[model samples]
Target: MSKKKKAKDIMPLLKDEPITEKHIGILEENLQKVPGAGKKGIEKALETLRKLKGAKKDETVNWQTYRNEELKFEFKYPKELDKQFISVVSESWPSWPPKMTIGIDATETDFMCEENPNYKDESGYGERERVKINNAIYCVTSTSGAAAGTKYVNYTYLTIKNSKFITLTFVLSYPNCSNFGEDNKLKKCEAEQKAFDPNKLADQILSTFKFISQ
Candidate 1:
């Protein structure tokens, strides 16, 4: 809406013709009406404008940190996520609910084959691959199941930090709301589920996890 404000102290200036958020929308809508070179410059300016406003679409800058002092690890999460939605368990075989949870498991077990790392319910089922997060290599697993018109998606990230195994898991249960045999309620629930992506949010949260020195 105005010139970008600097983090440092500076003098403010008045504008002869101020641009508003509505003007941005109008420009975006009519971008195709402009010629090729003109359109490119306008697009670049819009990108800079968005950066100056310190805003990104569908992204949150304010995040809360979760630290485990004894385990020597920490991660961040968006403040909009209720703390009640997260849990941590430190056990040999940690069980996960159909929700968000992070775990540090340092179990002494030989059941898992070193080559595959498949361990009963703890390991991911379908798509398994290696991914690098925060400069650390992690194995990712994707598992899915469905029951009674509801679908469950489980994404698990596993890695070893400081000789201890760590897991960052996100489970999404779609259309969890009970429709009670009503068409309108079912439609509303399905619409909500289709509008949001669980995996993208999982990636954002999982990337914040980092191991600290003991």
Candidate 2:
């Protein structure tokens, strides 16, 4: 008699097999056998599987390189994503240092959030986390919230090189536009809930970031 397959056995197949509803059905069946596996457990497992698949897909994506000679740094972004450079001016300090802003535009299904002026403190708008790339450490501050009826999520990476600050930001914004008023709000919330994961792409791009030493 053949033995029953476990989630571990099935998980390895995901690397080569295309993920489909059938694959999820198989995972759901095996997830039940996991100790303490509840609704949350199943959801978490599914999320992990999706992200893994996404990373795999990103492996085949064509990426373009962006190099800054003066800053002595470079990074890669998807060829399809738009890149923008902007300068911020401070009112209080005449000697306000120069900073560069890189914005990644959103797709039809996802929204990119821009920087918000109303956020007085970091805690009020975003959370801070640390990430390492190419043996270098960076501080990333991120936030997800709604503004002017539009939903937005953003991540900002900060690092210092040669006594100057280097910042890279990624923003996702979704516009809430529907004629149904409250129903529109509900739909927007639901859309946000179902939006594509942004962190995966962000990580893909950031992984290629490296500081070129002069």
RMSD of each: 11.2, 12.9
The 10-residue segment of model 2 with minimum total lDDT is: 83-92
- Those runs of model 1 whose alpha carbons end farther than 4 Å from true positions after fitting are 1-62, 78-139, 144-152, 159-166, 176-182, 212-214
Candidate 1 residue-wise lDDT at 177:
54
lDDT (Cα, tens digit) per residue for candidate 1, span 1-105: 212222011112112324457646755665666656456555755665555445433353467677777756677666443322222222322423213334555
Which segments of model 2 are wrong by more than 4 Å? 1-61, 79-124, 129-138, 143-148, 159-166, 177-195, 212-214
What range of 10 consecutive residues in model 1 has the weakest lDDT sum? Answer: 5-14
How well does each candidate superpose onto the true structure, as a TM-score? 0.44, 0.41
For candidate 1, list the clashing residue pairs, or say none: none
The positional error of residue 114 in candidate 1, measured at the CA in angstroms, is 13
